[model samples]
Target: MSEETRDEPQEQSLFEAPPMAEQERMVEAILFATAEPVTIRELTGRMPHGSEPREALEHLRRRYEGRGVQVTRIGEAWAIRTAPDLGFLMRQEVVETRKLSRAAIETLAIIAYHQPVTRAEIEEIRGVGVSRGTIDQLIEMDWIRFGRRRMTPGRPVTFVVTETFLDHFALETARDLPGLSELRAAGLLDSRPPPGEGEEDAEGEEATDEGQEDLFEE
Candidate 1:
């Protein structure tokens, strides 16, 4: 009946966000296209001003509950991942690019459990000198990286596991790693005492880069 009233409706329509269903689709498209887990802040930045990405994600996650691919959480981010039970079907497509030696595995485990650890500290725990090559290989794989330098003494640089490591293992954080008791229960650890210094050197030497077995198991 009036110009102001007619214009009011038109103005409201211009600022109104898309329906929840459309917002869900927007989130789905973004999560599908992204290779890494995305944070809510990132989704908010990409969506329309009036869109609610968090609520959209909640709806989308519930909708995908029993699907072959489901929405998953990684730390503070979200991702669309293969359903845990269906992961076997995708394993055949995975390819191992390189191998990790026993030394490398030990070094990685130590750094993962005790992050921000210096080279000297790693060697102290393992009772063996760590080769530069072992550290280099882990860094090259993007699984581990240099952390801050220690404040004491020479300020030796520390090593810590990266997001790639957490993603690969599907862990929310380093705290998710199994404890020693869990490892023993799973038969991953032996009751026998650890090898002596001499035996450790021998194993480390025998499992060189070229002779190492596959590090990634499908």
Candidate 2:
């Protein structure tokens, strides 16, 4: 072999990924195109083999700081969303005029407050049977999803609030949710005594069964 060949450096491939700034742009594009929050692993799967998506994401997130739109992390996923302070600008565009039925509202509250909860547990809390339509509606809305099944006799499937639910409420996690007193003040919870409370009172009023209906009405 020639001495010149031995001294020569390896040629860089033309197809090599661009610089980190460019990679940040790629990450931004992918995040913008995706409807749901994406994980670092997912980003890596879609990006070039040698690309550093995590670093790119960090750069992108910093670049978006104080902008009208910001990059946010929900659990293990990342998403581009409106800046919290400027969210009012888009409120008119995203307002949901339709109201959820009382049953659906109550069910959602129960699931949010006690996640990984089973149907029986929710029924036990609300003092009424949870209808199929209610659970189906929450699932259809993508606010709540099926979680792992319990280890008990029936091995019943559990329910949990989705990231969408947290985002809708502008919460980073379930722990950010308001306390029970705050919920009552916001009219999200009823003032009535909780289920199983009157069972021990000999003179307590009988518990009434509130009929469960469709998740939404009108």
List the candidates' TM-scores in order: 0.70, 0.71
* lDDT (Cα, 0-100) at 166 in candidate 2: 75
Candidate 2 has its poorest 10 consecutive residues by lDDT at 209-218
Candidate 2 RMSD to the correct structure: 9.0
What C-alpha RMSD separates each model from the true structure?
Answer: 8.6, 9.0
Model 2's TM-score against the true structure: 0.71
Give lDDT per model, in order.
0.75, 0.74
Show where candidate 2 strays beyond 4 Å: 1-17, 178-218
State the lDDT of candidate 2 residue by residue for 1-218, as single tens digits. Answer: 99999999988656887799888988999999997889999999998767899999999999999999988887678999988787657756843444444566767877877898998998888777777887888899888999999999989999999998776655678766644444343344456546665321122223322322222121
Candidate 2 overall Cα lDDT vs. reference? Answer: 0.74
- Can you write out model 1's per-residue Cα lDDT over 1-218, one digit (the tens) per residue? 89877778433445779899999999999999999999999999999988999999999999999999988887788889888677668756767435444677667778887898999998887777898888888899898999999999888999999877777666778777644443333343343434653224433543332222222211
Candidate with best lDDT: 1
